[model samples]
Target: MIDSVQRDSSLLVHFTLKLADGSTAESTRNNGKPALFCLGDGSLSEGLENQLIGLKVGDKHAFALESEDAFGGISPDLIQYFSRRDFMQAGEPEVGAIMLFSGMDGNEMPGVIREISGDSITVDFNHPLAGQTIHFDVEVLEINPVLEAANADPVG
Candidate 1:
């Protein structure tokens, strides 16, 4: 029998991600290798993963996902500002440049430069895919569901 998600505890899939305009954004087929990932580990988005459940090996699917359901809708609060002095400390800000900086709590955050003016630079911290819908075309190349009945270690 083809192993379904509930019957198989985990899965390893080779995927091809595409944009709404039919452009290929990423794919495992190009590297001549497959990408392995555990299900329900947040490696795949919830909405997308939810759609994958119950599918067996060798199943091909194409679907459209909304921005909110995909990478998530853009957030207004993600837009931030940095003083000219701060910009100088980091480096010069160039339009369309992605820069990594420490947040107030010292956590690293990536910000994209959108504009620069006399005393401040505008940065957008939202994910590049934040506001755009994505089209996903996935194939279930393999399935490795966990075997609860197996005699091996539980951690594996």
Candidate 2:
């Protein structure tokens, strides 16, 4: 039998994330390709996955998630300060600039520049949606069932 977003199923979908005031935060519709992700993967938050579970192909749903249920409250610790000299090679750092920095694990981490002092630059590494109530709108286009190995269809 074919799958339709049951447990552990991979899904190709289109999604829009909106803020509490109905402003679009992010959207897959703007991108050329639909997103593909499996259930329980880190691609989605647990609250979001809970809402998407059991949805069948071509199904559309909207979920209103609270700040805690969404990306969770922003942490003050995630805001860090760096020396102005540290950004010299990257050009001048300004407020609201999102820059990619290499972490200890060698992964690219994005931090938004929030303040610029005479010698210190404040950067926030928190998720952009953190501490905000967000609306998740999703449309499931296709389902790919996975067993020990993934035996799925192309998302064309």
Candidate 3:
């Protein structure tokens, strides 16, 4: 049977992300490879995965998502200040640089430098694309049905 994108389909696709201004933010095509993932997996956002449903192999599509539906709106609370000494071990911090900070959960999170003062640096923890609309150009390359375990029994 021919495969199509559905709730449990696995898909291989190439996609490009662009800003509202037409600037390309990222593209799997640029890397010469397509992304492979299953629907409902964390690899693709729910909003984006929903858009792919019903698409068939070799289908191409373009769409836009608002800030709230994309990466979400920037939060003032995510903007934080840190002492310069904290980064002295790394080097002089520069505005526009991205730094990895340890979170309370013991995971590293990326924060971008937004400002530098005498002894403090302001970092924005929000995603770089936060608060901006994004355009997506996607091409479906392959689609496969989700595999069920051999031991699984079919139920009505």
lDDT of 1 at 89: 69
Q: Write the per-residue lDDT of candidate 2 for residues 16-89, one digit (tens) a residue.
A: 98998889998999976678878876766777778878888889998899888889899999999999999889
Candidate 1 per-residue lDDT, tens place, 1-156, comes to: 447764324666677777778898788889867666566676667777777888878888888889887888889899998788987667777989999988899999998998999888999999887788788777776787444576587575
Candidate achieving the largest lDDT:
3
CA lDDT, every model vs. true structure: 0.78, 0.86, 0.88
After aligning candidate 3 to the native by TM-score, how far in Å is the CA of 85 from where it should be? 1.5
* Backbone N/Cα/C clashes per model: 4, 0, 0
lDDT of 1 at 83: 88
Better of 1 and 3 by TM-score: 3
Model 1 whole-model lDDT (C-alpha atoms)? 0.78
Reference-based TM-score of each model: 0.79, 0.85, 0.86
lDDT of 3 by residue, 1-156 (tens): 666788877888899999988999999988898877688767666788788999998999999988877788999999999998889788998899999999999999999999999998999999999999999999998888344454576798
Which segments of model 3 are wrong by more than 4 Å? 145-156
Q: What's the C-alpha lDDT at position 98 in model 2?
A: 94
